[model samples]
Target: MTTTAEPPRSPDPGPVERETVPRPSQDEDPADTFEQRKGTRWLEPRLLLQTAKQVAISGVLGQYNDKRELMGGISPGGYLDLGGAGTRDDDGNLWLDYVSDLGDSFEATYSVAALLSRPTLDLAPQEGEATTTRRGRLLVMGGDECYPAASVDEYENRLIGPYRAALPGKEPDAPFLQAVPGNHDWYDGLTAFMRTFCQRRWIGGWRTRQARSYFATRLSDRWWLWGIDIQFDTYLDEAQLAYFTEIARELQPGDAILLCTAKPSWVAATDEDCEAYATLDFLERTVIRPRGAGVRLALTGDRHHYSRYEAADLAQRITAGGGGAYLSATHHLPTSIQVPPPTSRARSKSPSVRYTQGAVYPTPEDSRRLRWGILRLPFTTPAFAGLLGGIYAVLAVALGAALREPARGLPADLRAVDAALRDAGWARLAGGLADSILALLLGLVVVGGAIAFTQDMGRWRGRTVGLLHGLAHLALAVSVIRLAVTLTAEVLAVPAPWSLALVVLLVFVGGGILAAELVAWYLLLADRARLNVNELFAGQAIPDRRNFLRLRLEPDETLTVFPVGLPRVPRGWERRPDWRAGERERFQPADGQLHPFLIEPPIRIPRTPPATGAATSRTDEAHRMDEAQRMDEAHRMDEALPGGMA
Candidate 1:
């Protein structure tokens, strides 16, 4: 029998060795974090149509879906009830459940699990020498573990059932699984989140060991991981503040802290000041910074995309929320953040990262599945306005003609309509009412247009777009006036008062529709420029990728991070080396609801203290080949799956 040579394992140092963990270099420049990429444009026609739908839904549901009160209520407690300690085995490393948006899609969850099963370390491949399957020691869910209101059924179908199917184990796989509640989980008063993640119940093959929403896990004696619950607001409550305050006292000097947040506050910054992510600032001042904790990294997952940003302090912020949710566009980000300049900062030289990924935009297929545009505002506004305008215009013109010559002005077919109005006593009120209505509509158009124009002045690009819309409105107004005076008097002989009313109403509605279109388009443009400033400043569009990170404390205390992307594993890696065709059947779903596993493109991580000359060369050639094989394997998997599984 032939045997393949295996890679040697690194020697394990004792847990007490403190010198092995290196402090972040002060001379490391933040500007050289990631390679600069061009910004993705937000003005695509499909995206514009999608964004209009989002705005309409938001208007009705309000950002948190009218469940803000339930989300805002605090769940008060500390970590003492669950022993407040992380898992410790004799392997000289820690394996964690590092994922976010972990519910809803069965296919995506299974793919990520399969990818994670391939690696034993940040860069090393796990050879199937001992067992066909691999498992982590601990699980750390980033957030949003459930979806669409956190109901019991959502937990069962979206979270528990899919994950159970993905991992495929009956016994306990990990010692503990910790999580923070996300906005969607809070929509149903956190009842399901608490039952599944915070209690002692068994979810799939994973056990819940957290007593509260927040936790502090000791990866080693010197390395720690802290996850804070942000609730619905930007501020932490008193109980949470007190709990962390007490825990900070025990942290040893030189201890590297990995902060896990429910939201990516740094990237969510609306302006240079970063006002939207104020909770992070609050945590920095009150907990991490004041106590002198070495906060090396922060991980988050709310935006449903992957992004990385680094500050002058050597602290890295990552968003890995792409587990199984609709993707968010990077181009719509705010303009304050700048990333990937291709060089280190000249002044601070502190290490920083700036990178983002392209998102899945709404397409023709999505439009067919959901008629979002037709159902929402901005799109529907025009049709509604036109209908109202047509009805009012006809009424006003008919009234004007009937009253003009009172005796013979009525056409034979419309005489009954005039008689009906007269019998109802509305005829007497028509002339004065028509004049008043015309004057009112004319005034509304003038004032509304002026207000909208003034608001766009500060934003030059917005002002330019609005100008086109304004011109359209102007044409409509002119047409309305001319139609009433010339067409009505010369052809229909309608009275001046009622004719003018018809003109005013049509002009007002048409102009308003034009103005609304301008506002919707302008907001989309501004959002794209502002929110994704990182990629724009970098000069390239970020790739479309979903990722989760695994941080392990080596025996020497040096921390290593394995940033894993979904479906990026080698094709045959998931199949047990000893498995026959019959053994593989045991892993398949009983209900025959199997989906062809997808593969992810490998992410290249730069070496520490990145070399300016040989950057992007650090990823080993062998590892690259392993990643390259995933494409062919993906096709094979696709062919293997049953027709209905896809």
Candidate 2:
């Protein structure tokens, strides 16, 4: 096998749990209250793992759909259209969609939603597959092309970094992609976007005419798409109007027309601008009316949410902007095709509220789809409680047991307590009081963490999340330093190895907690799959609920993501060398019942898992399958579904 180093991926966005055994970092929160510092009651690791595993199922892989069993057309007939969340910028910056997350936080309930989403994030490749098969061609909507200056530096960080992570393994196998600019993408006088994406405009002479107003693109020979790049409140310019007239003249009965612009005007930016009303008017008459003449849909992303709109009198509009920057909350659906002027201030800050927890977006018509978009720092509350509770409980038990037999692990001077307790009844009473104090502290930690879990708030980014994390560490450091100083005084006055150990342990514990918490900021804010094993690994990846032929592979294997449109794996690698075809597990579903099995098939699945960067699932496979005898006898590639089984 040819050996080539995989280009380095983005750095660890933060830290993650990496042990089968419980190994929690200790906390040192002052203002920490006694309870925040000392925790007890613990949830079994196996139970948490079980829950995590289950959520991982549907989360990593998306819900399966055979709807359309065909392609989306460009003509009124159809063409499949897809869009990426935002860009990584020219300089590889990972800018987030903060507005969306800010909006979602207010509505509350992230975990309740996560329960449904966890399973959708862990899907891997099938036995006969090589790349992410279901994904079709990708189209980019506006906003988040880059942040702030829209400089190449920002573009690279936001655009390149994220796209590289998201697209690396799949791009070579999936459909080709193209993008259009949003406000953020156009910041640097449009040069950043133009230079990074379309060095040569798909639209000839686009650069020369860019200042004149509207931009038009010829998708295929017959399909044409257009969008107006204008001020906060303005109509398509005379030039755009003139070009639009030409577009109308050029239109055929079934030509597909896609209209894109940054602001969807949730509530217009201003009362003085007549263009707000005029803009809507333009959409209705210029874009909507032409539907009869063959415009397919209006696609946009500035809204930050995913939505589909079909008015009885107007044309259809589909928005698939949720590609992970941050998420936004949704407002009530519009009452009529043409929105009436709002009489009061709009209450909702965002509009892309509801999300599918267990299912995929653009759901199959028959199966029913759910909408889900993950907001930033989703696990802060629950995780804090769970982590602190588990760790504190174990420590408390160990400490209590240690007191019963004080000399068991004691060093020289510290052992003085052991002899004193054994010698005098008074010392025993003092020991009892200390134990009580310890017990109470433990209880507080447990309860505090539990309370923290449901805190439910914040629309944070990497930088913002980092700031909070830095403070957490600072708080921890302060407490540890104080404890360390007190303990050090004892060390100088009367030396003992146990005293030194105590001081060191306190410092280490505090540091670990700080590090872990700091890393959480990145895992959550930066979207690092490992920093927080669960948040990044589980939350970021949608579960793979339905797929067939799950393949598990190890590193040092021959695999390559071909640079072709419909990506596939090499045939030679189909079967494992040691394991034969007969080794594959088998159990058919009896007459319409559910059947499930783990595929330890002969061939190894290409692609490394997240934790180890080793090909395939880091753990074993588990599946629940329904077969020939199952309900309706309808095949959904159902014959041998290993769909997201890994």
Candidate 3:
């Protein structure tokens, strides 16, 4: 095993350690803290509108305001030295953890944080396995620390609060923390992300070190990790490039790199011609390749699930975004992909690398079944249903008014409109809709909005499905109005004022629920076609199957990855009895149902020889031998398991 001396620490001592636990001020009761225990309801009307606005504003600002450029003045060179945390174990192995897309609702977020805060985890190996893994000395938060939008309050409540409560006290040899920014982090131009992470503050017991959003750190003598920030799927800024370029100068011919980014561009590139992958290709070819250093692995967390892809000779691409956000579907994942996609501008004469999909968390079948949960949207997101109801009510009222005779005094006009709706049949309603210009315009808006909402599928297909979805709602609203009018005025024989109130109530409640149900079904069918699949799951806001990666850099230079998954996160928690004793955290799972199992057998990537100063090509015979060895190892692991890995 190769050993390296520990890097020296800064002469200046950092901030004083204090009680980091999130508690109500001295005056408040402790029991009131966990009142809001669920994760972000993505379908909530207010949140949806706020998120849309932030996305729009951030998109515009990203074009003109490059936050990385401003960061250059604050931290001239964007690099951090975390090697002092002592990654090497007694046996000369290095351990590290990678988590991302966390900080949503309290239940899910804290459930994950509590487990990560443990000193070590003794995972019982399946059918044929050997050892237990210890906690990582180096913890890397991939991206999107908080969801919905990046703000001080959101981070404090969703992220820092739970994390602090999980590991409140600062220990002598605490893990060092570093992070990369995702799109959500950029919503506030990275103001909140910077303040929370780059300021070298303590998130629970983990110590922050990076001064810039992007960072490069050496893990061991032969291993390095780079967390790059590509803001909103945009190009990497010049300063970020320069920082890594400088770091590359210190690299030797054979050093291995583990590249981390906010989004999984390789996956995105497989579907469309986008600049995200182009920029990553530029970074690898221009910077790392020139130094003879190869990227052995690529990691990301925007998809909120665990998936691994491997090519014959290229680095493994893994998307493990199951930190603490809503679950995303894995059924639609392509069986294979080509990196530096054919349409990418960065494509070279060399053929694109073919990567085969490997293990995926929640299994594709389970992910498909999970989509059905969206059917409960009406109940889970009442506000969204209310918004739909409000729109239906407005359209019904407009059409009712248009059907009445020429304007009379207010009272007379109301009576005439009510009577017209009461006596109107389906045929009469349809005829009236043609002449109701106000109602016609509102219907058009509904259709247009629905069409715009449909994404991923091609224009024609999306428009067709979106149009059908809108028409279904329009028909439902008309039927609901007619039924409500009949029930109030004819069947019940209610008075004018009471009848009007009952009709409005029926339209809002009945129309809202039916309209929302239409949306749920549309999303479900669209997902079956692999269109708008993200929305299908996001609308559900599932807080289960959360996961993270624990990696061990072995003595022989091989890297083994343990993809840990929490099938169902615990919602209830209680204060730990030993919390005051300083031996345990502030809280533990109340149900004691926090069992984290492996997503699959550990994936081990064998060590490769360092790249030569000049590019070299492998002979057909050599390539065949390498493939055979990998297959033999995989076959052995498969035989050890009860059911073979897919």
Candidate 4:
């Protein structure tokens, strides 16, 4: 035989590349090493991207309809569908019955230009019926019409594109649209929304040189449309305010005023909470409540949902902002939000209703934005906490004798020496590199904490966000954890702030850096892990059978399967397969009666073929095939089980 050339191979391979084995690097510490975990943000990004591409193609031909021309001049030819109706039926079944039964009717979708040109939906169906008779012509409502750093381009993407994609009418730029600025819309000072939709000057494409972009529209002879820019607080100016007040008076007693604002006022947030806009009360006071004023229902959008509420004494306040914004999850329950008792059309205030059996009630106390500094005060804003902290700092220096009698100058026992500097002359170098400075910083921290002790932390709001910042420093001040670290740095003769501030700053700055890394990691890693809970566990672990069922490698270096099987696992080293690879599994023949499914593969039993004479080749092959099939069956059965399987 001729000699064959071959490449040399290493005696051993790396851990990840190996099959039927798991091992650590010989040079690395096995005790401290672990697999790194990661996560991702968007699901179906590819599918969403395709859908977005389709939208781009469909919208490519749209002329940039300016605020001036859109008032009455824009042309229309949009993909209109007045038939796609979807809602849950009485039995909780989804009902997507198209409106083909009714004549051509575009009930919902409306564009900026279209909204500025139309009037009246199919006459509001007979009394008590939810029948919608949408005329292809009517105004569209724009709520917080922009996205991340809401600029003109973002509006074109977040609002205009989606609006066109979701339209229910037949013509583009004909549905007489009304719009309001959302929090995000004003992200860049409401420039996007103002420049795009409120161009008429006076009131939506009208030439009124008003100070604000708020105005009223006449949708029909019997209908009035009003829009308030929640982001533009200055809109409630004297002239506009007067105009609305007068309009409220002129509105007929039976007229249907389509009231719109960025955020719907009916959500559980109290008036104080909704004070971000400072003007939601306009509907109730000016339009709806005025006696003899023909007040219809109010429509608004903000949180990206279609929520309808019957406010006390008022009609339904509908929040239908889902035209193109990010969809809101079913709004967190009645508790996280609250619906005040409905006011009687004739009365003032109503009582609050308790949660019913199947009702949601997330307590406001437990559910306000829990994000770090979600409720913030400006950095310059002085607060009670700061006031108290400042006082305590003064007290610490002044009342030092009263607070604590610990060793001041209590160093690691001091040693002093003098050194001569050719430039500055002789200087007394302390036992350690400036322990005095560390002591002062530490004292500053101590005083900051003392302030928290005096003030009630339970109550805080926007203006007070800055105050607690000083109080938050208490954790750094007198910390045994921090002191040990800071003292060590100073003794090593590290520079001043570096010895003290660096430690403190590292914890915070490092946390911020880590947070940023985590966010970036989240953006890159998770595919099915964007849910909040998963983010909370980001980088925590790639869980496996070793952790849950208590599987462990014994001190003798043998695999120990604990899962209530051949070997019992140690207390914390539980063995539970996490299905990380979505691997197919097989149940142990013996344990099938007990678990019926396994999250991992069963231990392979090394086997030898029957003696040549003991079985025929045909018989042996047949037997092997049968065993393989049984194993596959077991694998299928195991996959049927869920992760929380016991």
Candidate 5:
């Protein structure tokens, strides 16, 4: 054989001396490159108003748009091949990483992204044993990839920008990325989510593979992973059902599956009749189980915390949504729950499975202690406080206008009534019927809104708590007006026109603090009753206790899940020198950065093969029945909407 001339080899570049490089000052760096200085103020009045409007518009539009149906026209039966070709390790194993609810504050997002971007992680051993795990060849973003809402600009700034900076350059063996849309993602009808995640483009070093929002992928011969998009917790459309039904035809006798959904329906199922859990229960009973495939694990991330529950048979239902969002409360999580729920309309003979809460991040005690931070709402959520202050100011003006005047501007006939009203003490404030009615209407509106905000409890209980809360604010408003009138008129002897300014000032300042305190106390009391707990923490916006999961699939059909927690994300970062030369990542954590630790020991799940003979025969018969039912349903859908399918 003739030997070809080899290309000349370049000289080695040697190890980089990172400490010698001059770093850019904060002022010198571009504005876009810096991490967000603060977390999203969820309690901000303007943001809350904008988000509410978007939710209403999107909810109505999603009913008609149905983007998943459109995806069917492009690729009817498409499923990605994640395990094919160059994805396996030397021992034929596969590694995967899961993260969700990312794209909140920049510091938290970049902190998690930088840690996941590393090629390998040497985790601290549990009991003196050292273990090192490699980065996954696949990255699954479970849900809520961006927060508040989904849009091109929002994705670029809060999500894509940080992830790209974490791993700027593409490698030869870059991992594949896939995502399931959360409720927030559907706020824009999934336009941004589809364009960002479904276009087969690159998010930093990760490559996109799915042609649709929902995806099914084979991790190995014995394992499969399915992610389904249930927009707004609704049922899956017929096209999606058909897509999975076709994939089910290729399933073997004993394949194991990992189901990923946007929300933790099991947790929701514990409280109420969750439609999402009902849909998943139907899909699992009809499509997967009848084919002799067992769903060993279910993963979700909408709750923004890590909580794992296990059944008697060791089946895991995990919620690992703590990518980079506000910390959600875990104290209220149930210790035991039944999937499909007693209220669900499940058709199967074995309707529900009992799952006991196993491990939770931050512990219940810590979650309870964190709620105290909500007491600082006046400081943390100043805009919300200002909104309250503005309302109090209006009520103060109305109350002040209703007070009996000094018998000068009053009509001659009303002097007697004004004198009687003045001597009535607190009752004197209700003298003018028109202004009192206005104040009464405003108070009623506040009370109604507070009642509406208390979602976790029944209507009567919420109304009682809300009535107490509203009355507290009204009492404070009255007290402030009475005090201001005394201080300006009796003490300083100020004029009527100037006294109005003092009344506004005291009410706006004192009312804001006292009103916020009342809300905090109300939330604290209501939390014990499991009411408005989500708002209590969402208002706090705690950026720490972030977490993600790293999983490894072995050749022998065993999967190990490592839950990693970063208790405190680093706020300071330095630019790497190699990044300027177009080689490596740009920013890295500075000195005193905290290290990630395992929230708990690695959870191992082994696949159980299906039985043979009589069991196998029964499974085949059940599979046929399910298939026939699905076919009939699909045919009806086709008849109703002839142009609906591809």
Candidate 6:
């Protein structure tokens, strides 16, 4: 029997320690390789094609509705029940539960639930060796709980079902769940989110405890958690503001407050002058700061990563949106925001809280690692453009020779280049060959100039890029058609109608080329301000890792937060029996999680060092009590920004 031979393998270059390699030039396409010209931009033509289709659909249907005015209809007295009517568990046995970017991707939800169920070991601040497992009393979901849209069906499969499956032990006494609506939730007019979280509908054993999407819970006499619903950037209605005004009246001086909203005001407010938004500023003025609540902390979940910032006022901001969704980049945080260091070991005084700066992930901070991210872009834009360029070049040569016009630099007798086109029997168009070629070249220049001009234009940047991108594709198609028509009549030497039919096919191909490029542009460049899917889907270089924040309230009423960072999820995690498939069933678990929960070491909160022997004084207790009283009177503060619940 003859055996099939395996392909020959190249000899390994083996360890060359201390080797120096030059980085690719700035202008060079990162996807370029000797084996491929124009790079791997067309590597995932499907994604390009899909994006094109979506763009077309969006243009025709206007997929989004702006409800800014409508959502601003909140009533000042519209406060929701924190724990349903009158069930009071005011023993400070509270769990300030937090998760964001949830309600989508079943596998991711499953993994996140498993991760949350995984017990965490917390070390006592006073004891070097003592540790305990701590859990939250309430389950607070940040925002974007459902994927694609906020329809009830989407939530049933993508959000509630997977969570129930993952945390099967949840019972009537399970931590209460409260959420703020996100953009996706508002897509269906907040119908599903309202039903799931605000209608007190039972999801597993957890029921929604809010009358409206936004809420205020009395964590304790000295602590409270407030969740606001800024429905897709709409204003916080007067009712919501009025409810918080009442909350301010009940506040004690020494009490600490936690603010939870739908999106990260600090990160999302890139165009704003300050780190937070005008809405957040308004809220701080009207509600939070006015109460004199000590140690104000703002929690947001729109950005799918973990980031923490501290302003000079000691107010803390955090993004813990990585509850269960596609990961976002930490490097994309605006340069203006001040990130706090991970540990405060050297400081003499310990603040009431500490936060991790930048992103704390398991990935290495190496040059090669970052270079891979930059290279991902070429595959999306340049690669698609290259494929179109390649096709046009081939067609140009064929039609150019049929008309006897040599490509500008080539010799006149360069018949061997496209000798096959000579037999197309299009002698009549031979005289016009040179003219067609020149026109094609002119179109290229015009298209290039238009792109350059738009790039430099300051106003309407996104619209300009989109228009120019479309124009460039159209110019390419026009040039190709001009060349193809010359030969179309002769090739289909039947009736005039037959030749017309063949020409129409060529036009269809041109449309496909246009569609492909349109999709590529959106996938690669449309939302450059935030981390996008190109790096993971097209480049396939980075791992599918996620980061989250875990907050556990201490017995002494101090909040200790641990930034839990998960490693790159294994690709094979989808094979588990619990996995589901199809669009009718949700596509085969790619772009999501389906494995057992696993994570690197949890980032622990820094502790205050023990002090030398000292006795407590009644003055200290009296001072703390006085501070609590002062909190009740400090009401006229910063204006409050209308924020949201999921």
Top-lDDT candidate index:
3
Candidate rank order under lDDT: 3, 5, 6, 1, 2, 4
Estimate the TM-score for candidate 5: 0.85
Residue 517 shift from truth in candidate 5, angstroms: 1.6
lDDT of each: 0.46, 0.32, 0.77, 0.31, 0.74, 0.49
Clash count per candidate: 22, 105, 1, 53, 0, 38
Q: Name the regions of candidate 4 deviating beyond 4 angstroms.
A: 1-136, 161-174, 186-190, 200-212, 219-221, 230-235, 245-250, 265-291, 304-306, 311-314, 320-646
Q: Write the per-residue lDDT of candidate 1 for residues 511-539, one digit (tens) a residue.
A: 44544454444333433445222212111
Full-model lDDT, candidate 5: 0.74
Highest TM-score against the true fold, candidate: 3
- Write model 2 residue lDDT over 1-646, tens digit each, in one string: 0011111111221222122222111231111111111111112234355444533442333123211111111111011111111222232211111111100110111111111111112222233433321122223334444432355665544444323212222111122224445544533445565555443222100111121223454433234456555433344544344444544443443344555555554323222222344464455344433332333344455543444444322234444344333222233223222332333233321112111111112233311121122232224234533443344334323333335443544453345442332232333332443465654454444334323322121323333444554444434443443445354444454244444445445545554454344444434444321122223323322321211211111123211111111011111111123432212111111222211121121222121122242221111321122222222222322333332111
User: What are the models' TM-scores?
Assistant: 0.51, 0.33, 0.88, 0.36, 0.85, 0.59
Preferred candidate (TM-score higher): 4 or 5: 5
Query: For residues 235-302, could you state the per-residue lDDT of candidate 5 as single tens digits?
Result: 88878887776666546556888999999989997875544478888788767765667788899999
lDDT of 6 by residue, 160-274 (tens): 7655544433233444567888776776566677678755555443445565677776654466688887865656766666656665665554466778988775555453333
> Which of candidates 1 and 2 is the stronger one according to lDDT?
1
